[model samples]
Target: MRYFLIPALTAFLAAQTIRVGVDLVSVPVLVLSREGRVVPDLQPADFHLFDNDVPQAFVLDTSVSPLSVAIVVQANQDVRAYLPFIAKIGNAVDALLIGEAGEAAAVVYGDEVTVAKPFESGDLSLALRKLAPDGRNARAIDAGMRAIDLLRARASNHRRVLLYIGQPADHGSESPLDELRDAAETYNVTIHAVALPEIGKTFVSDTFSLQGLSSRSDRGGFKAGTDLGRLIPTVARTAAAAQSADPFSVLAAATGGTQLHFREQKQLEDAVAILGIELHSDYVLSFTPKGTGYHTLRVEVDVPGAKTHARPGYRLTTN
Candidate 1:
């Protein structure tokens, strides 16, 4: 029979999750310089947080807990060509993001939401290999909700994360987009995505920029953190590029996560590596929220030439 997070990883998870055990709203913040390096040696006193534009007292939590990731794939017939390349990424994912103590679960969505792999420790790529295209409908929202439901039961000591792999748009889903959006905050799950383009759509590679070191560095004109305000907007956008009602972009932005692009095997593997780096090199901030309903969050880094990215909002309901 299958199991949850392995026993060997339990000790590691606890050691990394040291924090006050109360009603704390934890937010993971990513601070990067224009050179594409994470800002190091930051103190709690060097930052400020605002809820709905009102400054609030908070504490910097230095916890790097093992990740509990839910990998959601859109396995519709339209994406049949992309499955072969995607299936071979299990070992890379197992080595990088799932690392030492992290656990992962896989979900594939088409006409129905299917759990390809339960939360486990070893050989994540096999989960991808099992994905086969089914019906024409792409029930991405429904599958995402199922992923969240799986993670909600996991221990709080693990940082919950969700990764979506599919086209930009959704075809048919029973759950409304708003419901899935709210569930992410309620469960404190960070959302990231590997977005692919729809078939037969001619895409230009000229506009894409990889999220790493600038080629300008070789030209002796490298800038450091020019955009200190590249933050998530409070309201998720209704469109992404040329797609109608892009759910992946909306979900990624709303949850302070990134939406990466991939067209071939190499780009897909590179996206996995970049994701591992971004997840491992973030700062986690925690605060005890006062009231209920919807809460808007804003974070500012005190360091010079440091840009910040964090979840824009969260929701709570007192029982």
Candidate 2:
């Protein structure tokens, strides 16, 4: 099984990660035939895995794998009107995102980062319902870092994931966005997010969309090297191409996850349902590589006219 990562994608993982090394590099992959349906069966030999553009040996996993998901939400006054709906989403998340086999932890940020539900104690609904918007500032990056910290402590058998629900841009995060992104990359964490605007600004999506990420009928539309160009941007913050006006988009794209938009209750619910389907259908490819520094990841499928979405890269350090 694979956990998930990539270079410059907005986020899931090789679709995004892998284990079996000092630091696991897991990449979740979505393979769609020309007909626009998920390609369920494929051997490791049917696909090629590359790190820093060089082909490497890998193990392919295409089954139901449990996840260790960290749910991070914004609890600032800016989105106060939507808090009621956000609070109630615990059921949807349980039924759709994590399910029975997976475990999840929750973190809410307003003036500070608060852990509403820990991994072991899991009544997310009650914890979420108790949330009350506290400060004027939105500390999204800080909240994200906290979520990553929680996920890192989990068992490696579970796929590492982070779900961010908040405003498009950061407001008062003392930590730079790159710091959080680097941490996510270093740990092979796949990030997915839904950007919430202030009250009236709901429903309108940002410049990028996940609508076509996994489904495109045109066989010529997407192929290897087409998606996940660079899963993780250089942690050094040298790559301006990975920069985004909306901070969530940067984290999502670079981590092999998608950044979605929603202002209404239905939009949020629909987003969760869509994410569930996407996550479950992925074919994860994992590898143990040598050396360190930043690694670029690329995925190639042998199936004809198959479009693939994968995490682009991950960072590794030798102890």
Candidate 3:
């Protein structure tokens, strides 16, 4: 049986009211081919959107809008060991700011999360320099939630997106996944997670190795002739660590964001290149929710073999 910290659907489905004289909900969607290439020039009629499972009136906004991006970097001991690789993140920022009016902010998650740089359009050399990894407790989930909240407050007009650069593991997080999902939907913030498994090598490699040994000992006790007594304790201790590899991926999917896992430094660079192009080529749709209840969203395109990716839904507040 699986249990979630936050009521998954309810947390994301906050009630939202029609603002001012408008009752439009804006959704940004990415249309990609099976090969991961962005498909452009999609017409409004090509899309069919359902709000709370009800067909809704909608329009597509394909104009190149300015972007407000929040970059979240994890700063834990394991990440610190891979500083040389983390330093390359500076180049990724350059690739991220593709639009003429794109602006970005950086947040570092260590013992405590800190806003390393306020939103700016110019060079990010100084801010990147200040983001050194050092903390023992890397509250990745908490820091990510705070970063989303900050982006929610500061970047309302622009297309808001969070670029999370770290391992999926959260050692000490005050904010739970449910709250984070709620905030992401409430603010219409899209998350793009770049998982650096190499940075947290010690934790991932060692912890999982123990888990594998424990599993083998259990399954092949007779043939392998391993001690079940010692292995059971090892499995119990490393159980929490096993869950660390999947949180960011889940967060990304829930918020209509993409998760890229990189094994080599070059893979990260290549993934960033594709992401930069995809970021500039999203379709924004506006639709009004049917009622002031929890609403689910679905986007379908008429293009053959084309896939559409967007947020699952948002909360409609009765304010």
Candidate 4:
């Protein structure tokens, strides 16, 4: 057997009460076809459960229990600047919490993670509406770690999910990416990220490109061959762009979650609507692992041309 171990396993165990034991290996799976439609009717026989490549028997839990969702929002200055122009997130929040048993927590992140509103079974639109941006920096990576911790500790049997809405950047985070990946697997938390890009934001490159400075222009149209004045702005823009690239996809992929990107505010609203349906359509699989440590989970549909989207596997903390 090939053993793949994650670093810092002991530290992760010391931090939180991670789900373990032979019976707690619950895997949530989403079945989809090649044409992008959700395949909802798959039986236990369709799935081949494995713990470290060893086949095992498992049961499917497609219960319609109340969903435990943490809405982690990024509230940096730039995102807050265009907040008014964007469509009301309340509509999106409303779409997610459609059922009577739906519960949600509103967490806003900047330099630090703040649970603006803890999990509540009531409607979250009002609380989300009242939320505003704070601090100068964004710490999406750190906030994500905190979100997973919150969902794991929640005293509910309902399916746990994290809805991250923010620009894909981590300015200052106490946790590293590897640790975050471990945390997600440790808790079996599913993360669905919605990338919120700034609209109409001005940058040095935008200005230079507007003035006939193309990539083909080696000197960037500077008479001195290089404008010292543009250096800082150019570097700043480059760093910002690099940071804005998708940082949460790995966590999403590891957690068997989907990542949605929006071009328009309306598209965000529509995506949220679609997510509402997907949440209710998931199938939860519970299996008893033979032992502890990290286990690989592969869920496939017997149907031809069907793709399965699920977390790679889970890491059970064993003493």
Candidate 5:
């Protein structure tokens, strides 16, 4: 018995530290055309990847593997109005997590983020229902950061998608934007933002007024309303500025993901469908850089007589 136990322990230790050859790093490069279509026919030779401005050799691994995704839903008042849009996301959830094994995805709402389904096929509607309750005080940026951190801890050789289901807001986040960006870069997590179109001008105006007045109420509610009326343009300008510098887009772009905006409600389903297909269709490439510091990587595809859209760059880990 002692001899058998000794061999088993040795084998377990060896398995825990097993490293694959240089040919097995699984970094997937998802190539999207300029028109928001995924180009699946591109071969390994068609791509040229660079690390720190130095060329690195890579291989395309097209094998099917489990995917881990984190869906951060903004549950603010603005997001609540788009309940149907949220419902459509439930449909997308069904499409991805139904049959895959070892696949885990969660829904983040307000200050709380919960794992709805863990890569199983049945009963995802419960998770969708969990996302329905709107949190009056949830912050979008904070939720995004939480999702990123969660995915980073659960890193895998398979693909990871950080799907954000609303606009960007930087309220009550303790981590700065730069920190979040660094974490995303380190983990190679691709961000997909679904910007819900403006529900209505009145909705936006009312939401803004309410947010401002909530900060101060000792002087009387009527006075707060008057003050907010005076500052309406400023509020509008602030919101506009916020949208222009969309944190979701910024995170997506920084980590080789695309940001999509849809005005019509039906388009949400289309976007999620596109995402599901892209997850299974991309080519994974791997390479080792020349030095040991942070290195920028650029992936390009040389498809003759065709235009391609790929990530501008990636920060390669060199430790």
Candidate 6:
């Protein structure tokens, strides 16, 4: 009698349909190469997707959908040197979204974190002018995080593209890395970082000069004893780590976005253009999780003989 009752309850529950909550789906793809060169003609099958180290399914659907893009310009002294590159990005995003009637784009600066552009009637040129460069004492990381939070809040059912242009710094952030990661996981925002050119040369050279005599005096007055080689690598490593730890790649990698480094204005402009093209060219897919709770999803294309660029996996909020 007990076995029969258990089987009957199970069957009744199975027969009852459960309506899940909002099933929002977004598929973001990161384009990268081991050598930093763009790989072309890649199909969906060339890629494998994972979620929490588990594999799911992959699907692609090419269609025009509404999109929300946030362009966060990091305008510190280092980025100020690359203003032309910044302007080019503004122009490219303006061009891309203006054609699609309902699409929206917002530009934020370190000084003013959130300002909306009239995607329908307002001119982007004016908004671009309004984005003041960072003040001498302004904080870049704080401004960037604020901008990201605002953008994430505004993105509803549309795909989001966040382009961060500047060096990432977390000097004032109080949140731990895990907390930051959780926020990104919850929001499903992809971060793409554009690291400006290296600007530490002058500072390094000055420091070397100041320390040269001290080291020589200590080393039996031998000039070779002041080996700049050791100092140079150490300085370089420290600077690189500081910059890399900035939330740029952290958000980007987690959300399946690409980070680009530019040495010239043209390269930066080209990268923005490429990003826009990829966002528009790719496909959108949606599926209900097989089980409840958090589910991982993998997306891939089925181009039999071509290579492909797609995200490894995405987290789904299940009902």
**TM-score top scorer:** 1
Ranking by TM-score: 1, 2, 3, 4, 5, 6
Tell me each candidate's RMSD, in Å, in order.
6.7, 7.7, 14.6, 16.0, 17.6, 19.5
TM-score of each: 0.82, 0.80, 0.74, 0.73, 0.68, 0.62
Model 2 residue 94 CA deviation in Å? 0.6
If the candidates were sorted by their lDDT against the true structure, best first, what order would they fall in? 1, 2, 3, 4, 5, 6
lDDT, each prediction: 0.72, 0.70, 0.60, 0.59, 0.51, 0.46
Candidate 6 lDDT for residue 146: 56
lDDT of 3: 0.60
Residue pairs that clash (backbone atoms under 3 angstroms), model 4 = 256-311
Best by lDDT: 1
Off by more than 4 A, model 6: 1-22, 29-59, 105-122, 136-141, 153-155, 174-178, 201-246, 290-297, 300-307, 315-319
lDDT of 1 by residue, 46-82 (tens): 7888888888888787755678889899888989999
Residue 140 error, candidate 5, Å:
2.2
Q: Judging by TM-score, tell me the better candidate of 3 and 5.
A: 3
Residues 1-319 of candidate 5 have per-residue lDDT tens digits of: 0122223222322222111123233355655333223344456788887766677787665544556677777665656766655655564444432123324455555555455554434345556555565556556666667777677666465456688777555455566776677767666677767666544432221211111111122211111122322211110122343235567656765665655555545455545543454444456676654544455566667744333333444454554
In the range 251-270, model 3's lDDT, one tens digit per residue, is 66566776665655555554
The regions of model 2 sitting more than 4 angstroms off are 1-24, 198-203, 206-241
When 3 and 4 are scored with lDDT, the better candidate is 3
lDDT of 4 by residue, 1-319 (tens): 0011112221221221112223467776655444334455467788876677787777776545666788888876758854542327664454343344556777778867888767744446666666576777888888887787778777556567888887766788888877877887887677777776644643222011112222322212111112212211110112342233457656666677766655555555645644554555456678776666777777766867765666767888873
**Clashes (candidate 2):** 50
lDDT of 2 at 83: 90
